[model samples]
Target: MKSRQIVLGILKSGPQTGYDITQLFQTSFAFFFDSSAGMVYPALRKLEKDGMVTKEIVPQQGKPDKNVFSITPAGEAEFAEYLHSPVEAESVKSDFLARLMFGEFVDPERIVQIVKDEIQQESEEIEQLQQRLSDYLPSHNRCMSTGQKLAFAYGINSSKTEIAFLKQWLQEHPDGK
Candidate 1:
């Protein structure tokens, strides 16, 4: 999904500043969606310009005013329409996968190192997501729902698969491990 849609869908929960939205991306949406810190502001501006959202400047003590975004009725309708639209196919863009595809060009030792590093990173991510799921599931009035929990489960499962694949690949391309 587009970052604009993600931002608008988030605004439906309540008004939030760009920082707040980015934080949500980091903590909650990080597993499934790939939103960058830079994407939030531009999406907010476009939404505001399109009258899909309205912004309010919230005053803070000893800080610059925060621009909080709220979804308009039109935005809600738009989001509902998006929900009705057929699910988009996810486009994979993995540098590691690409590198592995062209493994012959790289040194075997380097390939082994890369897969090992990926396994470590993926394992770490799985651990973090497990912790987040634990914290999220028990919270009262949590932002996440059963559907979101399922998504987290999917991520955990995918990460497990990735780690397994990497291990096997490393074994096949062994360089005196």
Candidate 2:
């Protein structure tokens, strides 16, 4: 999904300032998608211009002004339209797959190291997903939060299973000794 669509989803939840959106992105959307403030700000402006959202400037005592955005009825309609659209194919750009495909020409030891590094990273990601689940599963008020929690759980479990498969593959190789 494009960053614009993701931002619109966030705004649909409630009115929020640009800074708040950035924080939300870093905390929640970091797993599924990411966008910089540069992208978010421009997208917000375009959304406002298109009548999908409205902006309000809040004056701060000692800091810069904050631009808060709230989704309109049109925005909700647009979001619903997008939700009804068919899912798009995922982009396939896996570096590990590319390496494994051409691995006959590469150093076997280095490939093992690469696999080790990837598993380590996935372990940390799974930990983060676990934390999100613990915080949200039983009592989160937001419906989307529950959806997000389940999605993260699925992702974390899938990654763990893949890692296990890779570990088994490495173990079966004599050179892994």
Candidate 3:
């Protein structure tokens, strides 16, 4: 999805400063979507230019004025249009998988080490996600949308499945044959 659409979707929840939007991308949307301040600021400018959103400047003491963005009716319509559009297939770009494609040339011990490292990384990711969920749910569960909960579940379960698959593979190939 384009950054513009994502910005619009976030604004739909409520008005937010660009920094707040960036924070959401870094935290809430990090699991499924990748975004940066570079992407968000440009999208905000474009959306404003297109009359899809309005920006309000709030003065802050000893700090730069905050640019809070609110979605316009047009922005809501555009976001809705995007939501109703056909679902695109997910594209995964994994360096590990790419390396595995050339595994025959790599030493077996190296391959085993790579797989072990991946397991460790995925385990860490799952732990962080679970912690975020636990922290989020206590206060936000009533307000959290079903889609948000499903996304959390998907992320956790998929990570767990990856760990299981990797462990099974290691068990089946003790020597990384």
lDDT of 2 by residue, 1-177 (tens): 787777788888889888778866765676666567677788888999999999998999999988889999999999888888998887766788888777778688877877787788888988887766565444446455567757776778888997898888788873643
Candidate 3 lowest-lDDT run of ten = 135-144
Report the C-alpha lDDT of model 1 over 1-177, residue by residue, as the tens digit: 898888888898898889989987887788788778888898889999999999999899999988988999999999989989999999888888898788888787877887888899999999999987777656425666677878898999999998997788667768914
| Per-candidate alpha-carbon RMSD to the true structure | 2.4, 2.7, 1.5
**In model 2, what is the error at residue 83, expressed in angstroms?**
0.7
Model 2 residue 132 CA deviation in Å: 4.2
TM-score, every prediction: 0.87, 0.86, 0.94
Off by over 4 Å in 2: 132-145, 174-177
Rank candidates by TM-score, best first: 3, 1, 2
User: What C-alpha lDDT, on a 0 to 100 scale, does residue 53 get in candidate 2?
Assistant: 93
Predictions in order: lDDT: 0.86, 0.78, 0.89
Give me the displacement of residue 81 in model 1, in angstroms.
Answer: 0.8
Estimate the lDDT of model 2.
0.78
Question: lDDT at 141 for candidate 2?
Answer: 60
What range of 10 consecutive residues in model 2 has the weakest lDDT sum?
136-145
Q: Evaluate model 1: give its lDDT.
A: 0.86
Highest TM-score against the true fold, candidate: 3
Whichever of 1 and 3 has more TM-score, that candidate is 3
